[model samples]
Target chain A: SCYLIPNKMVPGDSNKECTDLKGNKHPLNSRWQTENCDECDCLEKEISCCSLVAIPVGYDKDNCQKIFKQEDCKYIVVEKKDPNKTCDVSQWI
Target chain B: SCYLIPNKMVPGDSNKECTDLKGNKHPLNSRWQTENCDECDCLEKEISCCSLVAIPVGYDKDNCQKIFKQEDCKYIVVEKKDPNKTCDVSQWI
Candidate 1:
């Protein structure tokens, strides 16, 4: 799976980069982009980099709390597909 | 070494969480109060979260460009202490 996160656009190119699940790419430094990110559905820097840990919306308010409660758990940014809060965060790199 | 990032305060306890550079901590759920973050030096949410990448200020404008040229490069966020535009990005969860 390839996840691309758009950047906040510092001063240069407002481009998006995606790589294999292994985090490796062909051209190496992310200069050679496959698709014209501009063609993507999202807008500008709004679609930049993927959130390091995509926090689920209703995570604590629903599911996790029932199982973990105030036990305090390590933060894990895993993809959530339950019917709870259904956080839809499609991140790019 | 622990690099804790203060978050953009969403409406709860304004605290900071620091983990080992290896990305692990003792009491996970991050509720334990190791230290009152207020005791630290920085300001409010400004210290909340750490940048996923502490982009070196002089990164492309100096070093890497000399070696990799305009061919494009992979984005690797590393702690920079160079003479050039050194970027100090202390990130957190």
Candidate 2:
């Protein structure tokens, strides 16, 4: 299940802790979130995540290379300099 | 301002609605969620999302093609047949 911890509760050490809908305290720096098929680490106030799914079947090697050239390939390209960068939740604050 | 709606509360229509910490109701099928740099649609019980960030600045055309190779390239590959697919929350249920 996903947990929605407030940005404020994430960086401070206090009795006021964030919790999931179940009311369980969501600890800081916990690897508790998932996105798509990838697991994520819940850091100070962000979720650092990445996927490890292999290239699509049949579209391997040269085939994958060829497909990557098509205009539609733009949709699949990873534009982030670091695709695994932490997703700052502080922005929501 | 992320909402922690229970998976059960997501699929049905009732007086029991989900809300963020602010106590505002999180409507179903709303484009209210986001991941990484992408906005997402909050569907019946899932988050349908995708990224629109342009394929990195410098690494365009042939340069991007070259980087698509190499073992480390696997780290940035988008392997989901459809990366824009909805993330089913039922699994969390």
Candidate 3:
């Protein structure tokens, strides 16, 4: 469920930290969510990130559409034609 | 992010499997989600379960209410009076 990225640093730098895709520096043991909504942890040797959003996989894909809401790290499944209406879908891991 | 439950078994049983809260048995290395949307893995000594649904923490609680949809394992933040309206809120880890 999570991906690991080896920690890389400047050649002359001595500090140990994780750098995110946006070039944000985080101290070891720190946790954060990326702009892409990936929940990441700054570990000793690498950065581990897992998706905070779960894409709708069991929905009626033909008649429904999945929209990602970045502000909340969630997905909304609604009718394709009438987005105001939510579509019922089975839940899965 | 996950909680571990020690694997318990019958006094005379020898198989190594995890028994979930619902009394379902899962073999080692197997993974599943509970009825409550907890993603779980059956490990060697315990069952690790993490909530698949992330509760809205940075939302406007005064003007919005979070409605949990059991069918989809997600929360919908809507207006206090008009449930059809979605409220804008800041994102947080």
Number of clashing pairs per prediction, in order: 23, 0, 0
Over the stretch A1-93, how does candidate 3's per-residue lDDT look in tens digits? 344455765677664788765567998899987644678898875676777767565878778766545567676777878868998869633
**TM-score, cand. 2 vs. native:** 0.26
TM-score of chain B of each: 0.18, 0.31, 0.81
DockQ rank order: 1, 2, 3
Residue B2, model 2, lDDT: 17
List runs of model 1 lying over 4 Å from the truth: A1-53, A61-93, B1-84
**lDDT over C-alpha atoms for residue A90 of model 2:** 18
lDDT of 2 at B42: 47
Better of 1 and 3 by lDDT: 3
Q: How many backbone clashes does candidate 2 have?
A: 0
lDDT for A14 (candidate 2): 50
* Native-referenced Cα lDDT, model 1: 0.28
Candidate 2, B2-93: lDDT as tens digits: 11122344334553333432334556666643323344444454333444332222222222121111112111312134323322221110
TM-score for candidate 3, please give it: 0.45
**lDDT tens per residue, model 3, B17-90:** 88765567898899997644678888875676777877565787788766555468776677867868987757
Residue range B1-93, candidate 1, lDDT tens digits:
112333335577653543422233423233332211111223343222222222222333322211111113223333233424433324322
Better of 1 and 3 by DockQ: 1
Model 3: residue B77 alpha-carbon error in angstroms: 36
